[model samples]
Target: MQLSEQCVLITGGARGLGHHLSLAFAREGAQVIINYHRSAQAAQALAAQLGPRQAIALQADVTDPAQVQAMLATAAGHFGRPLTTVVNNALAAFSFNGDARPKADAIGWDAFQSQFEGSVRGALNTVQAALPAMRAQRFGRVINIGTNLFQNPVVPYHDYTAAKAALLSLTRTLAGDLGPDGITVNMLSGGLLRSTDASAATPEAVFDYIAANTPLRSVTTPAEFADAALFFASPWARAVTGQNLVVDGGLVRD
Candidate 1:
């Protein structure tokens, strides 16, 4: 098992893409810690199925540094020491609704700041809370979830795209800063994933168009996206850091 005896913490793991990532890590023999803010029932059910020893779900608002610290402490207690991987998969409340597509003039500072708090602040809190343990073990993997839209800018989800761009910057800087400690930071950006709760509001015609235009002539599923994330967390990617791996069926060429 590539991740045997390793401990991984995934935020927003109660459902959608995060749920699949948690399962993928657990299947690779990792002791998974899932953090949820409002989906307690779903998180507990997932943990129960994975077995108490292999999976544990805790509640925490990643935007709150105090809550994030407490969640990390609880995870350490449940899974022993030396947190090996941290996946900052949490998203802001603004991302849930489909109405977030506001023109540049319509979008205000509050909207941008809210998204930043959820994407950037959440990752910072998780990294800060887990860095000490990683440094002690001299190994760590920090994978931030990002979007390919920022590169293509087809839909222009201004606030959301801007936030992910900032996260990419953080990923590179953190990789440089933490490299000496054997910690790697990277970003995984995927085109609109199919069959996720977040994409429920997206029009069927739009999805079909993307599928038709993509090189693979198919849509990317949450499970497929999880595979890319697993690579970043695995030993094979030891030399990979501060990079963005876009898994979008080669939709947008940089």
Candidate 2:
């Protein structure tokens, strides 16, 4: 689908990278549905700033199919068009402070389960809820957000990385199943993004070290990574699916 033809529903679109993505897509003429679980004010403000015609804020717990369906219906009502693209960019409630994370021995299965509920299960709900409309249109784009930690576990965010790795698996499998329907599924993996709320707790030296090691000699920014996400939904990438694009400036080769 082309940018102008899309009604993009971005999960967790209230802040951080998702917020930037909402602005990026709207700037390119896509009618955006900004979905937020709790940041109602931020989401509404963003939609208002983008103007009522181009965007609207929706509330939903992406992990719940019922809420997702309601949210989708409300979004479609606002736009009078089925959503053509979906971005699963919601992170499990987590901070980037590695020192504060549970040690490997202390981490339990529940830790992994919690992350999966927010990341993997949340994506599953949104994708399934959006599938009917997408299949009916014979055109859809499902972009899942991932982290480069899977490739180079720099700080070893085990639970987060494991859940994302699972998401990547689903992305590939679903791509094959939905390929005939023209719905492309792909993952965009970014490194520690520069100064998002999640990354705000990260130590400065950590950022400096990653910057020195990366090919770009600087950590990636949210907007820069979000633009790569836009490409996945564009006609330019119609031939692409089930692939993970690392937006970490050559920090890790896939």
Candidate 3:
């Protein structure tokens, strides 16, 4: 779908990387629905900043299937049309502070389970809730947020990466199942973002190390990744689905 033709809903879009995505979509004249679980005030402020004509904020916990369904209904009602694109950008509680993370041996099933709930299950709920509308229109763009840690585990982020690995699998398989309906599912993975609520705790040295090792010799900003996200949902990507686009400045080849 063209950016201007899109009624976009970005889960967890009130702040961090989602905030950038929301802004980017609004800049292209798309109506944006900013979903927030706990950041209602921030979400409302952003929607106001983006202007009522292009943005609105709604509260929904992506982990809850019922909430997701209701949120989708509210967004479509607000726009007076079914949503054309759904950005599965919501994240379970996590931080980019590797220093405080549990080691491989110290981790347990509960740790992995939580990540799965946030990464995989939450995505499933959003996708299923949005699918009927998409199928009716035969046009939808599902952009999932992922991480490069699964491709190259430079850090010992076992639980988070494993959950994302599962999500990647869903992206491909769902692509095959949904292609005929004109809905495309793709993943946008990035390494440690230079700055975000999740990555704000990243050590400065880690950022320097990644930049020096990357071909671009720089850390990719949330805005930069947000721009690339636009492509996956745009007409240019109509032929693309079940693919992973890594935007970590060439840190991960895939």
Candidate 3 structure quality by residue, lDDT tens digits, 32-101:
9999999989999999998877888999888999999999898888888888898988888888888988
Give per-candidate clash totals: 0, 0, 0
lDDT of 1 by residue, 113-158 (tens): 9889999999999999998899988899999999998878878588
Which candidate should be chosen as best, given lDDT against the real structure? 2
**lDDT, ranked from best to worst:** 2, 3, 1
Which tens-of-lDDT digit does each residue in 1-254 have in candidate 2?
A: 67998999999998999999999999999999999998999999999999989999999999999999999999888889998999999887999999899889899989899899999999999999999999999999999999888879878688999999999999999999999998999999998999799999999999999999998899999999989998998999999999999999899987
Top TM-score: which candidate number? 2
Model 3 quality (TM-score): 0.98
Answer with 1 or 2, whichever has the higher TM-score: 2
What C-alpha lDDT, on a 0 to 100 scale, does residue 52 get in candidate 1? 88
| Ten-residue region with minimum lDDT total, candidate 1 | 93-102
Record all residue pairs in model 1 with backbone atoms less than 3 Å apart, i.e. clashing. Answer: none
TM-score of 1: 0.96
Cα error of candidate 2 at position 199, Å: 0.3
